[model samples]
Target: MPYSEPNSATLTPTAIFGGMFNPPHFGHLHPLQDALNLLSLNKLALMPCHIPPHKVTPEVSTEHRLAMLALLCAEDRRFCIEDIEIRSNKTSYTVETLKQLKKRTQSPLWLFMGTDSFNSLRSWHQWQSLIQLCNIFVLKRGREALLHFPEISEYMDCSAKKPLNEAQLLSLHTQTGKVVALETKLLNVSSTQIRNEIRTRNESEAKISEALLPESVLNYIHKHHLYES
Candidate 1:
């Protein structure tokens, strides 16, 4: 469960790590760096979710999110921000995106999610087949709760035949269909926290407002007044 990757030495395999980068933060950077360091990543498509289903605040617009993501990852060649979901008008779902990503890359695909996401696997649309198309790499986000959450066990394909354990994560080499867990420290930063700061007081804005996002994104956010609105 260390931060070490279970399958980073493969032949140029790529892992798809998509998220609603409403405002890319340090927390987002950790997994990108961790996955790239731990997995045999040919390329990392940081596809920002266009329209996430359960998000409370609809998020800052897609354009703003994508632009900010681009600015943050521009210097890193291995990491990339794709408009895959943003380009589509339909609500973005993990299964649909993974299928599309599979077509785009010849390398094996690994879906990266955090422990919380994995735990709530049952709640996702088409949760069953989603786990089969590609291997999963779940990074432990925040501290592990004292309680045990086995929601992932209910994933559509989960059965006694394929248990969710460390062996399953490492079996991606030959099986190419499993889940891996990566244990890493949390950054304790979130986009929502930043937005709250901006909403609660004017001072927070000036403190972190030094081009933390892409120039274009900052312009758009200022124009829309997303969180402030």
Candidate 2:
């Protein structure tokens, strides 16, 4: 499933948040909204992996995940659901995905990830080539401790502080091969926990807070009997 190329002439700086949003939830959306605001990104693309390399394959089908993500994106004009990886029907590697996106638009591409994923950066295939393709943004929750990886640390550029101004972000976007850490108030929620809750608890006992999961997503999960044995 090839992605339709965007018009490069009218393109603006865009941020890509790729994940196995097995079931899209607030945890993924809130911090991304923060990134869009802090970095002054004109648009944010939510790229759901077809097959994640770092974790177990998602239990939910790709079609269902795409549908749930579509529901989430429909609420915001700036959000876009990029199905490039799902369409590929292969392992979704960030480096490869970014390379494809780069070919489609000249706009600066910003790759978003959590600090936990950043810590395991060396494990990714062709991790070294990622920074060359797009600026990497690491989002940290509260005062969470950062992992010590001197190899990655040497390339870190902390000059762009939080509440980044438009000028600073513009400067950062032009240059690649730098990692910037941004503080975000991310929710302490996990998809693993959500799946477990759904499987073990009855409907009344497994009441999912609307704050954590969107109503549309919750409804879809029940309608499809996902995460239930």
Candidate 3:
């Protein structure tokens, strides 16, 4: 099935949160909600890459990841599950995916990512081109100092001070080829830690908290016995 395109007239300034989503958890959802509110996005797309370029292949299959993401999206209407990467069935690269999305929609595009991932932007395939294709929103994580890459830093717009106004955010979407570091509280949860917890700890001891995942997703993990190996 072809990925359905949104009505450009109805939804403008769409933001995309793409990742492995190995097991969709609260850690992923919380920051996304923050981005939606901060950026004042019309719609935020939860995209799961078919094959991550920087990390090892996810332990769970794409089918399982997609289903978990679907469950996450079910909680809110604003969230959209985008399967463009999965549908392509190729090593997912941000630039190519953005290109495909750009071609389909006239609405402005914003790509959401973590500070850690943003630090390694230089390593991505055609990383420079990716920024030109859409606005980049970097969510700060940890106390790690923000590392600047000359290629992208020159275009970074640090003028977006704390307590961003609607006008500033609107300007970001309308304009292209700039990076903005969003100011929002972020959670410390990680997929690797969650997977290790499930693999090493017994169910009673593991007790996956609602803070880490939705109950529905936890139930699905237990039912499927994911990451038991």
lDDT of each: 0.62, 0.75, 0.75
- State every prediction's TM-score relative to the real structure: 0.73, 0.86, 0.86
- Candidate 2 lDDT over 1-229, as tens digits, reads 1112244324566678988888888888887777776766658889999888878888778889899999888767789988889889778999999889888878877788999888888888998787667667887777666665544423343322457765555555566655777777759887777777778866664676455788888888889999887
Residue 73 in candidate 2, Cα distance off native in Å: 1.4
For candidate 3, the per-residue lDDT at 5 reads 32
> Candidate 1 on 1-229: residue-level lDDT in tens?
1123344535455566777777776577665566555554447777787778877535555666766778667646777866778898888898888788768765566787777787777788987667656667776544553223342321222222233444443455434445666655566666777667556646556456433444454455556776774
The regions of model 3 sitting more than 4 angstroms off are: 1-11, 153-163
Clashes of each: 2, 0, 0
Candidate 1 deviant stretches above 4 angstroms = 1-11, 40-42, 56-59, 141-170, 204-226
| Candidate 1 lDDT score at position 62 | 61
Deviation (Å) of 122 in candidate 1: 1.2
Per-residue lDDT of model 3, residues 95-147, tens digit only: 99999998887877788888888888888899888877777888765454567
lDDT of 1: 0.62
Tell me how far the alpha carbon of residue 67 in candidate 3 is from the true structure, in angstroms, after superposition.
0.9
Candidate 3 pairs with clashing backbones = none
